[model samples]
Target: MRKWLPLIAVCAGSFLFLLDTTVVTVALPRIGADLSASVGQLQWVPDVYTLVLTVLMLAAGSLADRWGPRRTFLAGLVVFGLASLACGFSPDIGMLIAARGVQAIGGAALAVTGFALLVAHYDGRERGTAISVFFAVNGLGAAVGPLAGGVLTEYFGWSAIFFVNVPLVVLTAVFTVFALGRDTPARRGRFDLAGAAWFALGAASLVHGLTLGGEGRWTSPVTVGALVVSVVAFAAFGFVERRPEPLLDLRLFRDGGFTTLVACAAASTLTFAALVYVSLWLQTGRALGPVAAGLELAPLAVASFLTSTLAGRVLHRFPPRVLLGAGVLLGAAGCLLQLGLAVPAGLAVTGIGVGIAGPATGAAIVAAAPPGRAGMAAGILTTTRQFGQTLGVAVLGIAYQAGGLAPVYVVAAGCGGVTGLLALVPRKQARVTT
Candidate 1:
């Protein structure tokens, strides 16, 4: 039991970070009302965290290489704790959004280092067990986030959601300090400041434009300028990454399997984005309280957690293509089902589909990487998934504002179907299984 202290510390931090990604969903309405926030601001509360985390992820990985994962992870805990405090004390929506963005910086560090720390500390069977435990903890975080948020918000107010992280961070940090070994920087490579800048600018601009467009500002000069800047910034990012030691090695896309898996990663998060609006709809549209709305959504989280656990046991039995394709297609079907009045049923199906595909996709991407590029591949996969979640929220928020829940479901379903089929496409890669 004592030997697993390091794993517990790492999982604790990782779980907190992942939980924040979705825990805010059930509390959005409360936040909006309390902060007097507009829909766009509410969207940013979650989007800013994910967006910052997405853009900073690769850079964080590099930082971990330079500073050592233990130190980086500990620093992240401190930063995350501080930011959570600020979030709890935020007087207005703008302050909350800014704090969430700051929180993501810490989250990026935690996320990039968690696996590395595990790999360094454990080996063989113990390593495998540690990883499985880590994955399970992460899944539990996602599954319980909404329900936790709901309960906290219902009894203690929405600010409690942010305040809750303070103790957890302190506990995790204490365990990490004692359990983890001393730091040793692995690489002295120059950080890709230019590539990081370009990617961040591009991704932020893209999301900002989509948010503006969602708010019926598509014709506005700011919206047009943001969209244009996004294009130019991404182009610059591509150019910048062509350097010898780019932040993200753009050359990885040359692998057809990597590209496909990355796309699937992005697609997997569409439903995640959709759930934000679903929670809102349940509260504001259907007049359910936060707890009730979260309860209604409980099936999605529960089903996902259970399915992932079950899938992990038998994941090696199936081919990557089948698991990836079929799981997402099932999620797409679940999304379509939501177009009707069957919200819980659709959400449960979506959860199960995502759960089925989650482990298989991660394992396949790591396995397919070319030798030393595995870390980069994992970083890219994670960044792309977070970016997908950000994009989905922005785009689906637009659909929700323009038409309603129906349009959001349709768009999400359409994306899932397309990406699902893309995952099914044959590629010349070695067979891999979880």
Candidate 2:
């Protein structure tokens, strides 16, 4: 019973985290109507969470290492629960966005520590099963989220979507404290504050610039300054990482296989970002209601849940390159199909594509890491994924701002195509080949 408690607690928290990601898309139209949100503000509604989560994720492994997983996990639940309450009660878009930032802090912590706890609890073949279940539950949460959001938002209002988190989080916390016991002995690691600041600022600046430039002209003074800040900050971050005990080991990228796996995480998520655009189009362009839009978009989550479960089981039998390359191409095909207004079919295909790649990439990442650094590796993978999701939203938002939904879909397809090609390039030192 104790053995399974950790997995249960982690999955429950992760489910709530991912549920919010897709669920918000379904509520966007309602939020905009109620608050008179601008396009940029609406984008910020979701992207802000990804931004904070991505930035803080670099330090999540360090926090877990220093404090212990149980403590970190509990802290995340408290923060996330409180933030959800604030979000539900928000009277304006500004307040909701601010609350989302707080939510991201807790989310980043849970994401890193949850995977680390899972790895620590299970080993050998059982470990594989646990990891598979982890990815499967993630897919399932993402699958259920939109429908749940649709129902809640349609019947109870948008606030209901957020308010629902309060009880779920509270229950999860109780189960964790009682069943998971105490944290393990802590590992020592210096937190690289400088490196963390540089990277976060760099990412934020670049995202802000791109989002603004995409809204207007790239030559604007504000856009140009933001771009410059992003470049310098990222360059500084690269330099800082050269020091011993860096927040992230720069050498990890030197491994072609590991890098490819990270790319797979990014690419798969980039495709997932399309659903945001699709949801908006359904509500805004087609004039669909929240529940109607959610029902239409349900196939994406359903496909993801089905394909991810199967992919997790069969991952041991295929090469990462083949699985990821072919899978992402399938997603690219789905994106292309979306050009003709075949939204449900395209989304289902895209879901299948991401589902096939997600578990395989996650497993490969954990398997490829140097011994004793599984937690760090998980943090890096999740960070890369959130970064990709953020970039997708920014890029697609730009396209949408410039030319509307059609252009955004085209750009999304192009991104999927690039990731597909990159996946085929065989990684060096192919460790853990199936």
Candidate 3:
């Protein structure tokens, strides 16, 4: 029992952090009403968290390398707990958005270091088992988020969604301190402040611009300016990463396997983001309450949990390309099934697809990394996924507004098909376990 305490601690943190990614979806209506928020402000509630998480992930990974994963993860818990408190107490939309951004900063730390800690502690068959459990929990957290939010918000009020994290954070922190092994000696290196800044600017601007576009402001000067800034900042990030010890090693992209894994990571979330809009449609369009809407979406969660658990058990036996390609193709098919209000059927299919790809994607990305670069690899994987969520919500939100659910499903399916094809590309070196 004691031997698995660390896994418990890490999974607890992973569950809490990932839960926040979509937990707020069901509660958005309640939050908007209470805070007197506009539709745009409501969208920012979720987008802000992912945007910040996506931007800070690389820096957090590098920080973990410098400070050690244990310390970094502990720090993340503290920050996340504090941010959750602030979010619960927030009196206005702006305060809530700011607090959520802070929460993502903590989430980024937890995400990267948690993967590093798992890699540090487990190996061989044990490693495969640990990662499978980790990814299963990841799927569970994401899958159940909307349901949890609905129950909490329907009965306890919307603030309970954030407040619920307080006790979990406390318990997880204490368990981690006692059960997790002490960190290895920290790596010595100069932190890449320039690279971090450039990446942050680029990502933030890109998300902001997309958000504006979603709001039917594509021709607005602010939107155009934000897009332009994103382009220049990304260019600068590419240039800065050419340094010997950059924030993100540019050389990682050279590996076809690694690149494929990252693309799958992004696609998984991109397709999953449809759930947010689906939840919204249930409540606002179908006139269901929070709990009812959440219940309607339950099949996705159930399918994801079962599929991820099964995938974890066999994760070590198959090639990543086969698993990833098949998983994403299924997700695309699921999206297509949702074309005409077949919500439950489409979502369940999508859930299975996401579940199948989830563990394989995580294991492959981390496995493909060179020694001592697990943190970087994990960070890149998470960053891309979070960015995909951010982009999906923004883009899908636009699609929803323009032509309702039809366009949203079409766009999601199209993207998933392309991503699935990319994952099918031959990459002989991408093994999940040794």
Instruction: Return whichever of 2 and 3 wins on TM-score.
Output: 3
lDDT for 426 (candidate 3): 89
Best by TM-score: 3
TM-scores, all candidates, are: 0.93, 0.95, 0.97
**Model 2, span 31-148: residue lDDT tens:** 9889999877888988898888888887887677667878888899999999999999999999999999999898888888888888778886666667767877887776667788
| Residue 85 accuracy (lDDT) in model 3 | 97
Give Cα distance to truth, residue 40, candidate 3, Å: 0.6
Candidate 3, RMSD to the unseen true structure? 2.0
**lDDT, candidate 1, 238-321, per-residue tens:** 998888766777666776766777888788889888888888888889999888888887877777777776665666676787
Tens-place lDDT per residue, model 3, 1-434, is 67667888899999999999999999999999999999999999999999999999999988888889999999999999999999999999999999999999899999998888888888887777778778878888987899999999999999999999999999999999998988883467799999999999999999999999999899999999999999999999999898877787777677777777777788888766888888888898889998988888788888887888778678878888888988888888888988866878988899899889987888887777656777787788889889899999999999999988788889888888988998888875543221
Provide the lDDT at 412 for model 2. 75
Q: What is the lDDT of residue 360 in candidate 1?
A: 69
